[model samples]
Structures are given as structure tokens and as C-alpha cells.
Target: MSVADAVAPPRIRCLAVDDEPLALGMVCAFIEQTPFLELVGQHDSAVAALQAVHAQPAIELLFLDIKMPGLSGLELARVLQNGPRVIFTTAFNHYALEGYKVDALDYLLKPFGYEEFLRAALKARAYFALLAGGAAPAPVPPAAPEEDHIYLKVEYQLVRVTLADIVYVEGLKDYVKVHLASAARPLLVLTSLRRLGEKLPSRHFLRIHRSYIVGLGHVQAVARGTVQLRGQTLPVSEGYREAFDQFFNRWK
Candidate 1:
């Protein structure tokens, strides 16, 4: 075998789906140009893509478009809860929130350039690499002051969120829903709970469960195996129970 073949990185099998022929073609082209991505199939409908996914269980990634005729991209993602990761490509920016809700790896706006596409592809590569037990890349340095506030990618914009306003954070696979005191709906961002936990000030936020992090100041009551905030009760997993108890004792 050639040295190049032996040294080549493992390619992530990918499937592209878009109702528009041009859009579908562009996505497939991008996948082909990416060295770490292998284009396995291209389909113009979500149903066909679903079929492909079932037939080809080796597919690790999906470039999905949000708005399709019979089965929308969002619907497909929800149905494939344990399936391959998704990277949404769509013209409508409004679907960004929905995409995150379904735990998409990244969202590429319509008319995106190759640079944007490559950035999204790299994210997928890193994600799969981590899953394969590869060394993780260093976290990006926070742009804003880590103490006072931090910036979160909300939809297409980076919104500065004050540290104190956060009541809690709920982890959903590849996304986190930041529950704020000033907002009715939680702001969903594309990040893992462990990574976000590192960004938050440990003094104010304590992880109660693998899927939850609570702001100490917002917690009203601490009961056995649970904590209450804003009329909502959250579990305190066995792993974090000891640390939680220590924090609870400090206030008593």
C-alpha cells in the first residue's frame, strides 16, 4: 500500500438531502471535496434519505435541509434520535432554533461559501474523533470576560449573557438550553454540558446531574436527591450528590 493511503484519516460516511436539486448537488460537492468526509448518498427528499440511513447503517453524518415536502428535515432528525449526527443546510435562518432542538452538529445558512462549509465539516470531524477516543482539541478562549458574562450563539447572532441571569442549564445531547431569569423560553446553544461547565464560574454554578447545572443563587430549596428553582425540581445525580451536599451545608 502507498504511504498516503496508510496515513490517510478515516473518512466519515455522509449523506446529503435537500428537496432543491441545486442545493442537494452543492452539498454533495462539498462533501466530496472534504478529505475527511465521504459522500455515500444524495437524495432530494427526507424519505429517501431516511431509507438510505436505514439501509446504510455506516453513515456517520447527514447534511440535511429543514423544509421538505412530505418529511421535513427536523422531523427526520427527531425520528433518528440515535442515528448519525446532523448538519443543517437551509435558506431560512428561522429554523436554526429547531435545528439545535434536534441536536444538530452545525447550521449552515443558505448561499454559504466553501469556507463556511469547511468550518462546519471540521466541527463534525472533531466530534466523531472525540467519539472515537481521539485527543480533543483545546477549547476556544472565551471572547468576553469569563467572570461577568459570556457570549452564546443564539440563532445566527452571538448574544452576550450576564452570568447572574442564568438560573440553570439543561444539557440535551450536543446542545444546552440556558434557562434565564429574564426570559420565558430557554436559549439553546450548540455546546456540550461539560464544556459549558468549564466556562461558567464554579462558585455560582454547580453541576447537579450529568444533564443539569444549576446556579447556586437561584436554587430555592435542596431536598434529598433534588433541588428546586423557579417552581421546577431537578435531579441531583448520585455522582454529584456529595459535592451538592457540601454546598448545601455551607449555607446552613
Candidate 2:
């Protein structure tokens, strides 16, 4: 390798794939923060990721989630050969050994901080760096445990809705209506918005009003103390305005 080649930072073409929208958003955000990692695409499913991988041959790194509805990350890893090096991003701790069995570069537990994520990313960078330098790949470290999802009780049954699926929740006196993706109507549950908001991940959901709590991922537009969702606009109460503004400023 020449002097320029040794110093030149190789852009790691990356792709993020997770069934949870909020989770995928976080991974993409982390990738964008890394100077050497170039985000090529993001997908909500392993099937979609497979399609993207086939379409883009240059993608060299994958941040993949496990336990999706269909075509889990492990299955996708099995199907692809000579494909991008994968770093399994999952909520479950039990899958760590399974991930390494497939020769994954790393395992990223859910709700990982930037420091943890950056550590894994750098390992991938080092792996590629070694390959570029004509050396054997380095060993990847085991992942630490992190919180990931929440369960909600709706109607007469328990509903397991990932924090990512919740768009916005509306409180009507004693009941809170959860507006989630793929649901034709909101899931009305007997709970206060404040109570439900407390259960959700604070980084992803914000209580803008006494009656409404909006998921930051689903927020499309914000103007004049109001936030726009898919079809509804919710006001930001004076009590929460400052916090909402802070989140908006950082998000934008």
C-alpha cells in the first residue's frame, strides 16, 4: 500500500435494516454521525434489505435487526454470501452467540448509546482497514444488554407494539387512543396519556399536550407551537413548549 492509501480514509458504504422505524432511524442517525461511514440506504425489513443489497453492490456494511415479523436477520444473513459484513442490531441478549455463528462483525444491543455504536462501527472500520492492508480481520467484541421495546394493553387483550410503530397517542379523559402504523383505527386503551407516555422511550416520544403525545419519528412539520402528523395537527402546550422546542431544534 502506498502512503496515500494508508492515510486515505475509506468510506464504509453502509445500510441500516430494522423492522422498528424508530430503531432504524436511530441506526441511520448513528451512521450519519460517523465520518468514515457513508449511509447508502435504510430498510424496515430484512426482505427489503435483501433487495437493496442485490441492487447496490457497493454496500459493504450492514446494521441489521433481529426478530422481525418475517425473514428475520439471521435468515437473511444465511441467504447472503460474499455480501456486506453484518453487525447485528437487536434487543434480545440471547441472540449474541447465534449472530457470531453467522460470522457477523458485531452485535449491537438495542437502545445503544452513541459511544457503544461508535465502538462497533470502528471495529468494522478496522476490519476493512486490515483487509485493505492485506492482513487478517480482527475479532469483534460481545454486545452489552440494553432496553428495546414496550408492551401495551388494549381493549380486552395485550398488544405488543414496538415504540417505533406508535405515531401519536391521544388521551380522552380516561382512555388513550394509540395511533400506530398499519392499524385502520386507533387502539383505544383505558389509560391516561401521561401514564402511557411514561412507559414509552423518552428519546422517541414527546408529550406536547395534555391530551397528545407525539412520536418524534412521525412528526412531519412543526410551526407555531403545533406539530403535524400524518393527518392531524396537535398543539404544544405552554408547559411542554420549551421541551418540544428543544427537541425540534435538535431534530432539525
Candidate number achieving the greatest lDDT relative to the actual structure:
1
lDDT of 2 by residue, 1-252 (tens): 999678776789999998776567778888998988999999989999999999998999999998888899999988875789999998666899989889999897665567788889889988898888854335556557444556778778898777666789999989989998668898889888888887886866789988888877666677768998777899999989888888666444
For each candidate, give its TM-score against the true structure: 0.53, 0.59
- Candidate 1 structure quality by residue, lDDT tens digits, 1-252: 899688555899999998876567668878888888899999999999999999999999999999999999999999998999999997666798999999999998765556678878888887887898876544444335224579999889999997767899999988999999889999999999999999987766899999999976567677778998879999999999999988666434
lDDT by candidate, in order shown: 0.85, 0.83
Q: Identify the runs in model 1 with alpha carbons over 4 angstroms from their true place.
A: 1-8, 137-252
Q: Residue 28 CA error for candidate 1 (Å)?
A: 0.9
Error of 1 at 105 (Å): 0.2
TM-score, cand. 1 vs. native: 0.53
lDDT of 2: 0.83
